[model samples]
Target: MISRGSIVVMAIGGALLIISIAHHSQEWMRVASRLGPIISVILDGGLAISLISAGWWLRKQQTTLTPDE
Candidate 1:
C-alpha cells in the first residue's frame, strides 16, 4: 500500500509539473519577463521525475501493507 505522504507528494508534483509546462509554453515572458522560461522547464522536468520515482516506490511497497501479520 502507498503511504499517505506519497499520495500528497505525487499530487503536489503533478500540479507543479502542470504549472511549469504552462509557464514554459506561454509567451508572457516576452511581454513582461520575471523569472524566465528556463526555470519553468527545469522545474517541470524535476517534478515529473520525482512523481515517477515516488510512484515506483509506492508500487514496490505494495506487498508490505498489512494490519495483522
Candidate 2:
C-alpha cells in the first residue's frame, strides 16, 4: 500500500539519518567531548527514529486515503 511519495519520504529520511549520524559522531569526537558518548548517541537515535516514523506514518496515511481494489 505504499505510495511513491512515501517511498521518497522514507529514502530522504534514511539519507538524512545517515548524514546526521556521521556529522554528530565527528562532532562528538572533536567538539563535544564534554557531552560524552551517551548524549550524542541518544540525540542521533531520537532524530533517526522520528524521521523514519514520520515517513512510515505518511505512507500509512496515503494508503488509507486511496480507494481499495
Candidate 3:
C-alpha cells in the first residue's frame, strides 16, 4: 500500500516539475540564467527528479515488504 508521506513527496515533486517547466519562459529563463548553470540544473532537474524517485522507491519497498495475504 502507498503511504501518505510518499504521496505528499510525489505531489511536491510533481509541483516542482511543473514549476521547472514554467520557469523556462522568457522572463523566468532570464532570471534562472543569471543564477548560473550548476544551480539551475540542480534546482530545476535534480531536486524534482530525486523527490519523485524517492517517493516511488518508498512505495515499491513498502509493497515488496508486505506479506502476501
Candidate 4:
C-alpha cells in the first residue's frame, strides 16, 4: 500500500508539472526568458519528475519491506 506522504509528494509533483506546462504561455515568457528557457524547463520539469519518481520509489520500498499480516 502507498503511504500518505508518498501520495502527497506525487500529487505535488503532478501539480508542479501542470504549472510548468502552463508557464510556457506568452504571459509567463518573461519569467522564462529571465531564467533562460532551457534552464527553466529543466528545473521545473526535472524537479517535478524527480519528485514523482522519488515518491513512487518510496512506496515501492515501503511495500517491499513491510511484513504482510
Candidate 5:
C-alpha cells in the first residue's frame, strides 16, 4: 500500500534513476555528438520531477494536522 505522497516521490525518483543511468552511459564510454541532447533531456526531466515532488511533499507535511484529542 502506497500513499499519494509516496507514489509521487517514487515516480519522480524512478524516472530520474532510469534516465540518469541512461544519460551517463556515455561518460564512461567514447563520446558521441548525438549524446548531448539526450543527456540534457534526461537531466531536465529528472530535475523537474524531483523539484515538483519535493515541493508537494513539503506542502503536504506543512498542511497536515495533529490530533489534540
Candidate 6:
C-alpha cells in the first residue's frame, strides 16, 4: 500500500511538473523567463526525478507487503 505521505508528495510533484511545462509555452514564457532556463530545468528535472523515485519506492513497498500466494 502506498502511504499517504507518498501520495501527497506525488501530487505535489505532478503539479510542479505541469506548471513547469505550461510555463514553457510561448505565451507562458514571459512568466517563466523570470526564473530563467537553467533554474527552470533544475526545478522541473528535480521534481520529476523525485516523483519517479517516490513512485518506484512505493511500488517496491507494495510488492514486498503482498503475499506470494
Candidate 2 regions with alpha-carbon error over 4 angstroms: 36-45, 65-69
Residues 7-56 of candidate 2: C-alpha lDDT, one tens digit per residue: 77778778877877787777767873657545766777677768788889
TM-score of 4: 0.74
Clashing pairs in 6: none
- TM-score on alpha carbons, each prediction: 0.54, 0.64, 0.67, 0.74, 0.41, 0.52
- How would the candidate models be sorted by lDDT, starting from the highest? 4, 3, 2, 1, 6, 5
Off by over 4 Å in 3: 28-43, 67-69
The segments of candidate 4 whose C-alpha lies over 4 angstroms from its true place after superposition are 27-35
For model 2, give the 10-residue run with minimal summed lDDT. 32-41
- Which parts of model 5 have CA positions greater than 4 angstroms off? 1-33, 67-69
Which digits, one per residue and each the tens of the lDDT, describe model 4 over residues 1-69?
668998899999999988886785443566635456566667888999999999888888888885769
- lDDT tens readout by residue for model 6, 7-62: 67677777877776676553345564555765766777687778967866875786
Best by lDDT: 4
Candidate 1 residue lDDT tens string, 1-23: 55677677677777878877787
TM-score computed on alpha carbons, candidate 2? 0.64
Predicted structure 6, TM vs. truth:
0.52
| Window of ten residues with lowest summed lDDT in model 3 | 24-33
Candidate lDDT values, in order: 0.71, 0.75, 0.76, 0.80, 0.64, 0.69
Candidate 2 lDDT (Cα, 0 to 1): 0.75
Steric collisions counted per model: 0, 0, 0, 0, 0, 0
Candidate 3 per-residue C-alpha lDDT over 2-47 given as tens digits, one digit per residue, 9 for 90 to 100 = 7898888888998997787666544455663555644665668778
**Steric clash pairs (candidate 5):** none
The root-mean-square deviation over C-alpha atoms between each candidate and the true structure, in angstroms, is 4.0, 3.1, 3.5, 3.1, 5.1, 4.5
Task: Identify the leading candidate in terms of TM-score.
Answer: 4
Give the lowest summed-lDDT range of ten residues in model 5: 1-10
